[model samples]
Structures are given as C-alpha cells and as structure tokens.
Target: MASNKFKIILWSVGILMLIFLGFFLYQLTQSESVNSIMILLMLLLGLILGGVIAFLASKKLVSEPAVITESSHTIAESMRKVFKVVSAEGHFNEIYNYEETTKLFNFIPSKKKALVIVQAKVLVGYDFEKFKWEVDEQNRKVKLLNFPAPEILSTETDYKYYNIEEQFFNLFSKDDLAKVQQNGKQQVIEAAKKSHLPEVAAEQMRTLLTELLAGKNFLLENPAKISETKNLIDYRNMNNSR
Candidate 1:
C-alpha cells in the first residue's frame, strides 16, 4: 500500500512538472521580453522540489529503518531455539497373532499359533526449529510467514508375547515382535494426529510470539498471513496426496 501511494505521488508530480514546463515554453514563445534566466530559475526550483518529494517518498516507503531491521533480527535469532510448543500423548494397544500349518502328501496337518500384546505411547507436537517469520516494519507488525506442519515427534512402545498354545506349530520370531511394536507405534501416532494437538501447538506459538514481541515494543499481527496450523494441516495433507 505504501509503495502504491508513493507511485501515485511520483506520477502526479511528474505530470505537474510537465504542465509547468509546457506553460513556461508557451510564455517564452509569446513574450519577447520574458527573461530566459527567470524561466530557467523557475524550472530549477520545480526540479529541486520534485527531487525532495521523491527522496521523502523513497525514504518513508521503500527503505526499512535500521532500528526496525535490528528488531527483526533479534526476534529471528530468539525464535531459532527449538520450542516443544504443544504435546499430545496417546496410548495404543493392539493384538498381534498369526497361524501356520504344514500339510503332508495325503492327510494329516499340524498347526501353530502365536500371539502378542502390544502397547505404545506417542508424543506429537511442533518443533519450532523449522518455524519461519517476517517483520512488517512498515505496518509495525510481526508476521509469522511459514512453519513446519505438526508431526509425531517421538513414539515409545512396550510389547510382550503371549505363551504359545501350540509351540510346535506357532512360534513368535524376533522379526514378528519387531513388526508388532512398529505397528503399535504407528497406530498411536495416527491417533494422536487425529486429535487437536497441531492447533493447540500453533496457538501456543502465537501466544509466545505475542509476548516476546510485546517486550520489544512490537505488536504481533493476528491471523498472520500463513501461520494458522489448521490451514497448514490441510495444505500438508493436500500436498501429500499429490
């Protein structure tokens, strides 16, 4: 907006200068006694005034003051630290079982069965290490420009195998236990994601930024250009689907 206003002023001044020049030229042609030196002096005055206007416009709208730049850098540096903005804990329990049997040439078959009880706890939140932002010095506002989507930060699983009912036929292998634990962790993560953890984390971050900037005499712009976590989640899902 500031730039647009500056452009308008620049064009208006240019057009006014052209009109003044044209009038001066016409007057010089019509009056033989019109002093050439006076006309040059008037044009120089107009040029100097126009230059001043241009300089003021550029200074006010095009360039950021050093103090503003310093403030922005200070905020950026402070935000570089990792923030565990919000966390959601999820508990998941799943049953893992498989059966196998061997068949002989004609008839008799032996079967095996194995089962495991798997449980896990998952933690999900935003790591502010990837958070991004910009300072709108012209507007005296701090803007959250971009940030990483919420994700499952960590998963811890505890699982145990049930005693085999038929040891000869169904036995749990090391790979089977590993797969069960992994599946439990994945389920917990998915459950946590479905909750409102991301939105909570975003709101926490917004509050933190507001407080931080307030101390520096800067105001945080609400409904930041692209910082809302709800929108971010939708965007991330859309991108992943693609």
Candidate 2:
C-alpha cells in the first residue's frame, strides 16, 4: 500500500512537471518578440534539468539508508541461526531446521541493492515452550523500553522462569511424552538440567512430570494454550475474590 502511494506521488509530480514544461513551450511560441521568449525558454529548460537532477539525487539518498537497514537485518537474522545452533539442546538439534531468503531490488541505475528479508522458522518438537519464552521475553522487554532489549544474564533468567512455568502448565501432555520412557529418560533428565529454567519454575515442572508418568492428559497443549488458561484462571479468581 505504501509503495503504491509513493508511486502515485512520483507520477503526479512528473505529470505536473510535464504540464509546466508544455506551458513554457506554448508561451515561447506565441510571443512576437523572440529574444525574451528564447531566454525564458532557456531558463525553463534549466529549471527542468535542475529538478530532474534533484529528484535523482534525493532518490539515491533515500534508497541508501533503506538498503543498509535491510542488509543489517539480514545479517542479524543469520547471526541468530548460527548462535542457536551453538547453544541449542540435542532435542532441538534432532527436531528442527532453519532457513532464510532475501528479496533484492535494484531501484536505480547504480549498483545499489535493497533487500526485503524473510525468515522461515519450523518447530518439529512438541515442546516449544523454551522457544516461546525467548520470543515472549524479547517482545516484552522491547515493548517496555521501546528498544531492542539486550539478552543479558539477568534478563535471560527472568525469561527462563517465565517460559518454564508457562510451559509446565501448558505444553506437557501424556500423549506427547508417551514415547519418552525409561529408554529416553536419560535424555529428558539431561535436557531438563541444561534448560534455562529457574529453580522455582523447575520445581513446578515436577507436577507435570508426575502427570506424564501417570499417563494423565492436560487440557492445554502449548505455551499459548497455557497463557489462555492463565488468563481465564486470573479472570475467574478475580471475580470470585470480589
């Protein structure tokens, strides 16, 4: 939509310039005294040339920053995938894959390149609470400060707690864990230990473990599912307390 509007504005400006040029040409032809009219025509031609040069220069100036911004975004996204691999658990390594693509535009005659970046994220595991926590924390901090929040240790800890409790009450399900028995118990233990969950949040996960072991199913199935549940519980509790 914005691109369409910009195109319309550009076309309108060009049309107005052409109309002005036509009027100047008509005035030059109709005048009986050719000297003043010739001079006026030369001035009008200079103005048109000046306007075109200014338009091209402005387009180059505007396009450079947008190209740089898109390049930076692409680089940042690449860094994220590289870091995720370096830090991810074996469970994640086994389950998922990452890919990215960029759309390039050459808006001008120069070798200047503008990009539109798109990242594709696919999750294969049933347990995506950890990923959700990281995303939510980033979003929350960004919202609070109106800036990209740095992933410092303290902020990461907070996110871990939030996501773990969030996942425990939400994503763990009997069917999901049915295949993860004593054979895979070691893997599960290692994953839980290496996870970024806080102590309190880890303790809460014990109840989920118990339910899974006993072959009971939770009504909720994901972090988003748990968040909805939390909202409903909060609403009901608030009403009841009153």
Full-model lDDT for every candidate: 0.63, 0.34
Q: List TM-scores for all candidates, in order.
A: 0.48, 0.25
Model 1 residue 130 CA deviation in Å: 2.4
lDDT of 2 by residue, 1-242 (tens): 55556656777877787787778778777876879677886877787786787577556545434443343333433332222111112222121111222333434222211121112111111122232322233223211111111111111100011111112223434543332222133333333334443222323333343355346333223332222222110111111110
Give the least accurate 10-residue stretch of model 1, judged by summed lDDT: 233-242
- Tell me, by TM-score, which candidate is best: 1
Compute the lDDT for candidate 2.
0.34
- Candidate 1: regions farther than 4 A off: 1-117, 162-167, 224-227, 231-242
TM-score of 1: 0.48
For model 1, residues 173-227, the per-residue Cα lDDT tens digits are 7785565556555555555566665566556556667788889888877555324
